[model samples]
Target: MTIGFSSRTSRVARVAVCCSAVCTLAALAVATNPEGAGLPFGTGAQDAKAGQEPPSLYRPGTQARPRAGAPRVPRDVSAVSWLVADAGTGEVLAAHNAHRKLPPASTLKALFALTVLPGLPAGLRHTVERAELAGVGAGSSLVGVKENRTYRVADLWRGVFLSSGNDAVRVLAALNGGWRATAEQMQDKARSLGARDTRVVSPDGYDAPGQVSSAYDLAVFGRAGLRNAEFAAYCSTATAKFPAGGWSYDIQNTNRLLTGAGVDRYPGLIGIKNGYTSKAGNTLIAAAKRGGRTLVVTVMRPRTGGGLAVYEEARSLLDWGFRAAGRVDAVGSLVPPRPAAAPQTGPESPPVLEEKEEVTGPGWPAAGVITGAAGLGAAAVALALRLKSGRLVRD
Candidate 1:
């Protein structure tokens, strides 16, 4: 009896009513806005708060206390979180523990793609990297790329998505500078994009102590990745051929949503990424487009099983999102709750915010806002916890 996003839609009208009743629970989460009113113009914080948890948004069965025999939304495959969003508008569509930072496994390639696509000269080709073979550290997956072999940057991009090629990623990272500098650049790019909970410790999303990202951060990466037409095209490919020592080898996409056989199908599904480890279990970041609307979904540390659970969850979520987005209103009135006395202002504090927070403006914790918004419908507020920041308690 797994509760699903689609299963919840049968009660959308009820959800709307319930939302009007429940919005006050979150009023204290807002800053300085006593009325908890609609967003103010150019104030990014207001916009993010508006998006944080919509009044009408409903996800099935995410209440604080569970009813007996209730179907549980799957836990992440790792100890971290996950998120989803619309690539075109960069709107968050769904999330699960989106701010909880944890190892990304190979999913970090998406960021590698983002960093490489924008900085490199246009039409630059990839050549087999000499260092790719000489131990780029541990956890390397072999796509059998021959040392010193040459391929187009475009071709390597396909390898990165299809095979989760650490070697190829190392080559790309090294091309920018070195792994250390490349990782730093990725951090910078993440910061610029407002991925507050994201921190990179490796060129590959390997299991490093501090290498982590939230589902929200991944969604941000996904949104940014989609902007690179080449990377987007590469990720969509189920298979790619690259030359190695004058011969061609085929690499398959690790993302089961795109190429996995016998999985529940998601209509309009497009490209993204997947990850796994004994510790991480199964992780995935997927995207799809329907009726001019696009959505991204990330599943981290999901229940261990046939590995089809991720797709099943994804399929259900996409179905619900497409329907919900069409029928639901994105804006609503905020019920003013008794303030908890605004985090205690100091004598040095500036009055009146000094600067009013702008909507969709810079510096808001994008990861928290997006993840919290995605969890609104599901009642899964745990999705908004930031694990790296020690915000969410571990189970």
Candidate 2:
């Protein structure tokens, strides 16, 4: 079939370019990645035997699909593992060691929030219980949930998003039943979302023995969360008030790209979440909108620079994804497979594309490409469309 992509959105098509570093197992297995966590994928005979192969470009020591005229994936990307993808279509523009699992730190909260946000009403009120906060891990970030205090569920969510608070996650997990139960629910939620790389050990994303998530899974959580109205509201919220006894204090979101708290303000930025630990270093999920397109990026455990590299790398990736839009094809897809009759844990779980209704719009992106304009201005996109004829996309 023949399809015409809008010069604006076409720019997003197949924008993925070559990765500077084809991260190998030896290069990735740094001290920060404990217990051979950075091992490259698709190395052994086992990988060849396994029926469920990830997109070729995403395996260990691999680069994203390369296009003739496309720009290179930013070499300055310092994270050990990272991915850039279209949020709406779940089309992965670029990835490097995308499935390498490592400690997620607080960024795992996005999964926790996604697991619970749908079932709970934002307006529901609950009083804090001391027992609920008891299991919070040491050195964990806190949003200061006070005992015997009544708070709207919205406020608690703010605590979770804005402060990355374990205390608030504890209370909400308590409300959800218990933290242990919530962790199990989160695991199920990850499976349903096709985030096969994540293992939920704590709903709060605290460092734990078995807790780990991949760049691909974190991007999955960010993209899925952006689809929900409540999730969108909470994550995008820059600052909010929380009760402290009779008074309240303000807490700003730690997402540097959102509030520009420690870094320069990112244009068209939509908040997602950020995380850190002595072990995890700095892991972040950031989404930005521009020219009718939204892109999400995940960076896990930068090796050289400290926490700042996480935000800077995300910014660099956002810039690349926007510019590369319509210039390349997706190396692999982030879309979860459709329901199939097969074992969930086995090596045969391959990708199954979701069924779509039909395309009726004048300038719709092709079958696999998803595009939409956001609240941000589209003047640049408008000009780009005016300068060039629409790109032809054949499916």
Candidate 3:
């Protein structure tokens, strides 16, 4: 199907190109750090295999199939794409066009949270700086945090998850560095999580050029985010308060599911995120829990049908997921796999790491060490790495 890809085509193309480069540089950084990609995380084959398989696969005429005359799987949105999963098991219950890339709008924050969640310092207070207000066109839902404002790192996350506050996201991004650096890091995290259809061009999920992700990728992020008790608690909130200048601004969650509107007008609604733009119409990531079962749903570019089109799609998907596999005890094994003896566990002569003498992108890469640059820089690095291994380009 032909998407109405706008003239911002250059921006989107540049994002893909840049991310390729960032991936290359990130690989180099890890290699140079001597830690490789195996820092605290175990580098064993078993650890790598975890979360790599479908949570559950149904066999025809098995107990896993829905009962006779149970609801059929939902239809895929025409312009939109989606995936539904059993969150507890990380098993994809149903998916349509799961690999297709599309604008994510504010839903990009789902990933923004994932990148920062691991690093949030316990009980650390961060002062919001004036320079953090750098991005243009932050929307109306700001915390009204002033220049030189102070807030707890925890509160900043609350603002981001609950209010979808662009200003809060900006402050967090600025604290990390500029959006350019933070976005590069975000893409790296998304890659590490195996989100093949995602790229971040903005710290907050603004309708910026080249900031796009697929429904499948969003589902992955939403599931991951829910695992964070803090984020889950934040999203579940219907209202939040941030006070300044002797007054408190009461911010409400934009997710209708939390508001008991639209498809949430049904039952068992939990929380996630919502997004929209001229390019990306009424996108949503939603989840529901009933009888100890959790399901995540994402939809993008819903046909201009109506307001709750995306929510309706989500509800149907959620219902199907519960029926497809009713309350599996586990998505992944809770017990750790038995350890296998390493060929040589004592770091006996670290594996010889290879470095290419030259690097290039689609165009030529200037002969230099991979530096963290945005857009084209990232793409160039990915391309150079590909060339070093003599492998054809693959997304």
Candidate 3 clashes: the total is: 9
Give the range where candidate 3 is weakest over 10 consecutive residues by summed lDDT: 55-64
Q: Any idea what lDDT model 1 has?
A: 0.61
| Preferred candidate (TM-score higher): 1 or 3 | 3
Which has the higher lDDT value, candidate number 1 or candidate number 2?
A: 2
Question: What's the TM for model 2?
Answer: 0.74
Per-residue lDDT tens digits for candidate 2, residues 1-395, read 76566555566432311111222222233322332222356354444322244456346853576578988889988789999999988888888888888999999999999988877788999988889889889898998888999988999999999999999999899889888899999999998888888999888888889899999899999999999989999999998888887799999998989998778989999889999999889999999999999999999998987669899999999999998878877877778776756535557764443456232222122331122222112334444444445354437
- Stretches off by above 4 angstroms in model 1 are 1-80, 121-129, 329-395
Candidate with top TM-score is: 2
lDDT by residue (1-395, candidate 3, tens digit) is 74343345445555667676666676466444432234235444333333343323211111123455655665554544776778787766556666567889888888898887667663677776667776647344665667776677767776787777788888777777767888998999787766756888876777877778987688888888888887787767777777564667777777876776544453777688887767778888898898898888888877856877777777777777777665332332212234445544456754432454333322123333344344446566555545444475447
- Give one digit per residue, the lDDT tens place, for model 1 in 61-144: 221222344333334333235444556655554444555666677777788778877776535765665665555656666565
lDDT of 3 at 306: 85
lDDT (C-alpha) at residue 389 in model 2:
52
The true-versus-predicted C-alpha distance at residue 190 of model 2, in Å, is: 0.4
lDDT of 1 at 327: 42
lDDT of every predicted structure (CA atoms): 0.61, 0.80, 0.67
